[model samples]
Target: MPTVWVLGAGQLGAMLKQAAYPLALNVEPVEPDSEHLPNIAADDIVTVEREQWPDTPVTRHLSSQAGFINADIFGRIADRFHQKSMLDDLAISTAPWRVVNTDSTAQEMHAELGAHVLLKRREGGYDGKGQHWLHKDDGGAIPADWLGTGIAEQKIPFDEELSLVGARDKDGNKVFYPLTLNLHVNGILMASISPLSRVAHLQSQAEAMLGKIMDSTGYVGVMAMECFRVGDALMVNELAPRVHNSGHWTQAGACVSQFEMHLRAVSGLPLKAPDVRGQSVMINVIGVERNIGWLKIPATQCYWYGKDVRPGRKLGHINLNHPQKSVVQTALSELHTLLPQNYDQVFAWVKQELERA
Candidate 1:
């Protein structure tokens, strides 16, 4: 079997390990900064997550640099799009935004953007961290921590948030899963419903935008693009250069999971169509440990990441797959009934989507 070395043995890496077995690929997990690279063969294929940029002789030997090893374009695509002109050139719509210096006062940003502005660090922020919301009435004071290079974007009152997970092979072939509807709590993703019923009309546009991004970057492997649905239009929110959270529903609800598709793409295999098996919803298990009670629900599956529990950490997720949307709704209702306090927001969102569906 061909050996594939995966850097960063986190949850995604573990999912990749499980996904790689069916292809007869051996996945060896390695620490990003480990110096024990002497034993690896030259031909071994190495892979890393988007945020992990390892610069070492072994990584260089595997390829000239870290991001270039397999998917050569990620070093540029992993972070938020730095220039508004870039999005315009790609024919993708985004909220009005401007790159601002850290020292720029919120008053100045408010003056330029509006009363409601979101300050985001140019790099390295995820799940609602590294962001500051400024209100016009708050005066000119900028958050001390936001005093660095970042981007200021107008806070959009979007109807909903959607994400698409897709894969591309070396031959330029591409395949994508259906757009997933997402709900966020405190900037962290709390739940995702795949094959969004209300926004089914935007699928083609989403696919076209994703295609443009992958083609423009000569991207290989799986890529995720998040968007905001405003009225009848979809505005690109950002891009994730690897397997994504929204697509986690694929593990139980699709013919081929996103993790497997990513490995197949990077391994130079023909990409498979992302065929949905059923109506599905994936709930993020954040800041809490797993409870067996959750798994007892019909058609529900739980994925627990063996990590230390923290207030905002993603410890695992629960996916519910059913043949009909009504069944999924019932499951959500039962969940809310079981844990009303913890799932109030989740139940409300799921109920709204179910009604819209």
Candidate 2:
């Protein structure tokens, strides 16, 4: 088997490495900034954990390699400006938006988009960083530096935020997991649940939207699409070109994990829709020390990233799943005392979702 090389040795890369072990595949997760580059054979496949990365010697080398997966698709989707444009060109629904430049004015933005606007950096920004909210009441001017470096979008109201994680292979075969209901607190994902019984009606629509993107780009590997549930319709919020945080629950819930699916797709392995089992909840362990108490709960699994903990940093994630909804609920209830008070809202949201008849 050819080696699989992953750029950006973060948690995603680590998980990918773990996934490859069971398949007897060699996977290397390289630090993006490291000056030394890996020896690339003609059959070795290259992929990225991050949508955007700084241009460095190692990155330059891997990007130029013939075996790189989705190398041409990353740059186009990395910039929010081009991403939104592509969505528009495809007739996909997204919030009204425009590129912010030197001559752009707040009045014009409000008039065109709405009284409320969100400015996102065109380049790198994730986990809710590099964003500015402008409201009519605040009465502020768009920062001069943000011009030409950001995309301004109307702050449209939506019933809920959801995400779809799908994978497409070299043969153009595609498979998608069920739509996942997500909860974001201050722009950071706090929790997510999948195989939702209530939103079953929207699954195919979500898949169609994401399938259009992957098919258009000839994208190969796992891709995540974040969306806004507006009434009976869905609007695209952002696109992740690689495995996404929202899909982490697949580690314990699906027949094939997202990490494994990504590896399979990029390596010319057979691809098919994974058999989803029962209910799955993923609680992001942000900025918290790992606690052994989490293991005490039944049907609960923890994946600690082994990274230094800081305020707002993604330390790890906890996955809970069971064939019975009642069992999953009971386990979630058990986690209340084990985790910090910060997770109170997350559990509360989960409770509401479980009770959704």
lDDT of 2 by residue, 47-152 (tens): 9899888889998988999999988899899999899999999999999998999888888888888889999999887899999988877888898888888999
TM-score versus the correct structure, for each prediction: 0.91, 0.99
Q: After superposition, how far is residue 15 of candidate 1 from its true place, in Å?
A: 0.4
Q: Write the per-residue lDDT of candidate 1 for residues 1-357, one digit (tens) a residue.
A: 557777667888888899998999987766666677635565666676655456766555445433234455555655554434567787789888877775687777887899899888777678998788889886657767667667889989998899999888878899999999999998899999887666788889999989988887777888898899999889988888788899999998998999899888888877879879878999888887567788788888889999998988999888889988888888887766555377688878878886777
- Among residues 3 or more apart in sequence or in different chains, the pairs in candidate 1 whose N, CA or C atoms overlap within 3 Å are 102-147, 102-148
Error of 2 at 312 (Å): 0.6
Instruction: Please report the TM-score between candidate 1 and the true structure.
Output: 0.91
Cα error, residue 82 of model 2, in Å, equals 0.8
**Candidate 2 weakest ten by summed lDDT:** 133-142
Q: Model 2, which residues run further than 4 Å from truth?
A: none
Whole-model lDDT per candidate: 0.79, 0.92
